[model samples]
Target: MNPDIYKLLIIDDHPIVAEGIAAIASRQKNITCKSITCLKDLLSVIASEQFDMCITDLEFPDTNGFQFIHILQDKLPSCKILIYTMHEEPWVIARLSELNISGAVSKHTDTSELSTAITSIRMGNKYFSEVFATLNKRKSTTEGHKIPELSKREKEVLSYLAEGLSTSQIAALLCLSSNTIQTYRKRLMEKLNAKNVAELVSKGKEIF
Candidate 1:
């Protein structure tokens, strides 16, 4: 066991996913992964061990996700929390932010993104997916880059984008066609001087 290794605990209801994630994470430099599939198992193991970070999903069989968070915070306050679940609604993101969870990534994202998230959080920087980052913007500006003002419709689309919605998803929610949403996205990117959708989000957060 390397003394400099980072111990990362993976808490999820599905044992297979937890184990898979642990295996992938173990390949990172000096990081060891541990999986806990149930709350019952966690209670016993937590008392005897300490971790540098914890990645948890908000769903579990024995207890609510919120309860699990409370327990994790109470029992291991020093451990940074990384959210790895599909629940990325505005309310859910906001609640996790209030709880001081350090980072989040969509389940739909690639396995490679998991390594990025871990690295970001390990460096004391918050990690969030494009949409999550848009919604969870912390600093007021990105190097004093002045954000161009947007129209009401554009703002509406931006709001939905911040909530982590896809173009089709936003179109459905707004009762507009996907083409119209695409138009809005293009207009937004051009107006904001963003080269691509990813940069659109990266820059939009400065204003959002």
Candidate 2:
């Protein structure tokens, strides 16, 4: 591969994960990673900059799931869009295809797989994890499978809860009334069939 020919963008909200990807890619002789979190900022930068490929998370603090790919493909039709997410649902795979994503990778996977995904997308090939490929499409057997259908807000609340936020604190951060936050908590528990906070935390880790 030509060292000067490839540039990559990583769009994930987690600072640590983004930095980790940069660190790994920096060690490679022919690849580099630029990290950013916001979609608008990404689009603005991309307009002025050229990237060979993009690896983005399916979720973000400011956007719907994986919708950034649509905007990115519009702006840079030649750039490869790889979806790096913890979501292992078969429907997600179908959805990525519909959006013309270049690849999909699971966060729980090894770093080598990610590096391969980058190279594959850069080479105009699609990548999919073996585990994700083997998962049953008709009935998800993954943990937290029972809680598959989460509202966007519910998914955000669950992530924060796993981060150790109290319901009141989460309510304040989300700008919702305490009662509304409580309602979200209740609904999350019911949907996931969680027995308690501890179980909810455990389950959250499995899915994300």
Candidate 3:
């Protein structure tokens, strides 16, 4: 591969969707694209290869798409992730920066925009549709309630939780037992008044 060319991986459960993006995105200068149908296939590829970007959809049936994005970020820390999904909820938009995602474009956008997004991210800039900015603004305005201050330990837990680590994974990373991680998660949830992980990350990302 040419050093000047960027490689983008399209990950959508539907082979056709992935291929369509790959085909269109491949036309851009200094860019190439390959598509995968599922995360399992991606795991197989990740062990031996890396790419410039991973374009993913958030509606996988067999996996929670947010968690999957976290996994991709973990596995490919240098690769920018571009969400190419139909989901545009406020929670999703606010959590994008929290998750360290580099860029995003709604699937409903023109196919040419995909090329534009890829080009922008390849140049080390981010590309999100107006929808994300609008949603993020709304989240900041309407969900302006503040939470209590957290201890240093609680803040640590929230950061890892935002990264999408499971209880056991966080425990192992923190060198504590799983039970301790669970306790921290519980306390973080209570502090934030979050009923679930999604809510926890969404609210906590703003604070962190």
Candidate 4:
């Protein structure tokens, strides 16, 4: 859309997925890409370069997806974030809202939709693919209540935050805000009555 070229960084634990996104981005006009498949490498790569947008997977072998997003945003505040994940649950949608990510698309989403998402973020707009939109719609119908049983999204965020990802990184993966994630943290603490992050971690491990 804009005349300026966009630089993209992709963080996925899978080599195939990273390569696929890189290939697609390379073929697209006005865009360039760099991809990383490990958290250590991902951090180092971002530190060494600047990017206009970041497309990341939600889960990784070394770190939680949402936490990783938080880390990337903190390390590179100006970079727009796009979540490409297989998670399609309603709570996942709500979690993304909390993180305030720029865009979200399912791994199952077609290339056209993926292109549209990248374009939207590059143009300074947020995009949520149909799969994401549907999840949010379903979540809204359930109101803002959390089941006494923690949902997978909450557990993931909690476990990761406990593992040391800053709230900002968690926000990025969950497509939410650091503050919003803080809310989740506070609520989780209150629910578990853990009183602190360490206790929360212990509880998280017990639950999972």
Candidate 5:
């Protein structure tokens, strides 16, 4: 093994799927690939060895993929993650973006696109499949008329509100003043054309 090689890990419940990804990754000259079929083996390998990137499937037999992303983030803060899944929901992509995931590709994408996604992510860029991009564009076009763009802080407040947090609770969580949180709430209602908090939460659920 080359000491300077980039180490990549592929995690999926399906052994053949994992092996297929590993096979593609191994074709890179400076890349070393390891594939594991379960969370336990993934955790063990992560504990013992450092990886540059991880390609993971969302559907695991025993664990949720979103929760696994959190675990991987905690364990390997510097390792980039690329999601490979059949899920193409715009909200799912939005949630991943909120969580700051490195990139995502649909399972239906070609191996060439997978290699492109890996290369882009490794070079500190986010990659999404064309389908994801197209869906997002259409969603934005339709929603733009009704919803104004939200600032980062406003989006945070809206997300907290959707989770049933009060102004005071959101303020404390975001380390902002109660008045500030209320102001954000008001802005959210206006931008989303919401009549009240209930409506605001409903609209926020759709977009965020």
Candidate 6:
């Protein structure tokens, strides 16, 4: 692989989807694209090669897509990740944003949006689909009216919590101590007026 060229990996279970992404990437003179359909192959490739970016689906046969994102970030600190999946849940999008992912486009979105996401992320900017962008804007507009405003860290905790991550797992991902995560958990519950984790998650979905 030439060091001067931009390398991209496309991971999707659907063969046609992977090929489509590769085809799109092939049009760029500076980008070289490779497609894989499973986690094993993806890990194998990452072990032997470096990539500038990875576009992946949110569901995999053996692992969660967000977990894959964490693994990729750990392995290739500089590689930008863009989620290209059909998942349009607000909580999912909020979690991605909380994780500081570079960009995302739904499979249902216009193909041009994927190109825009790739270009923006390559330039160190964040990109979200128009729907998500509008949802985020509405969230901002309704803050403190229908829903209480949460601090940045509180929102981060809520995002992870909605994903069913335990406090320890969230702590490890955020580089915080277990006690600190617990503190955040307690604060989140109080702020959301929830009696417990279930209620917290329930209220969180309504808020975010």
Better of 1 and 4 by TM-score: 4
CA lDDT of each candidate? 0.77, 0.74, 0.77, 0.78, 0.79, 0.81
Per-residue lDDT for 1-208 in model 1, tens only?
Answer: 2459898999998888898788778877889888888888788878888888999887654554666677888998988888888865544554565577788888888878887899888888888887677755632234332345678899889878877899999999889999899888876764565667777877778776
lDDT of 6 by residue, 24-112 (tens): 77776699898888878878999999999999997765555776787899998888888998976544555565565787788898888
Compare the candidates by lDDT and give the number of the best one.
6
Candidates by TM-score, descending order? 4, 3, 6, 5, 2, 1
lDDT of 2 by residue, 1-208 (tens): 3557578888888989999888866776677678888877887887788787888887665654455777788888887887788977654554554467777789999998988877676667888777566653433455433335677898889988888999899999999988888777766664454668889878767666
How do the predictions measure up, each by TM-score? Answer: 0.62, 0.64, 0.67, 0.69, 0.64, 0.66
- Which of 2 and 5 is the better model by lDDT? 5
**Candidate 6 regions with alpha-carbon error over 4 angstroms:** 139-208
Clashes of each: 0, 0, 0, 17, 0, 0
- Stronger candidate by lDDT (2 vs 3): 3
Candidate 4 stretches greater than 4 Å from native: 1-4, 148-208
Clashing pairs in 3: none
Q: RMSD in angstroms, candidate 2? A: 9.5
- Model 5 CA deviation exceeding 4 Å by range: 1-3, 138-208
Give the C-alpha miss distance for residue 143 in model 6, angstroms.
7.5
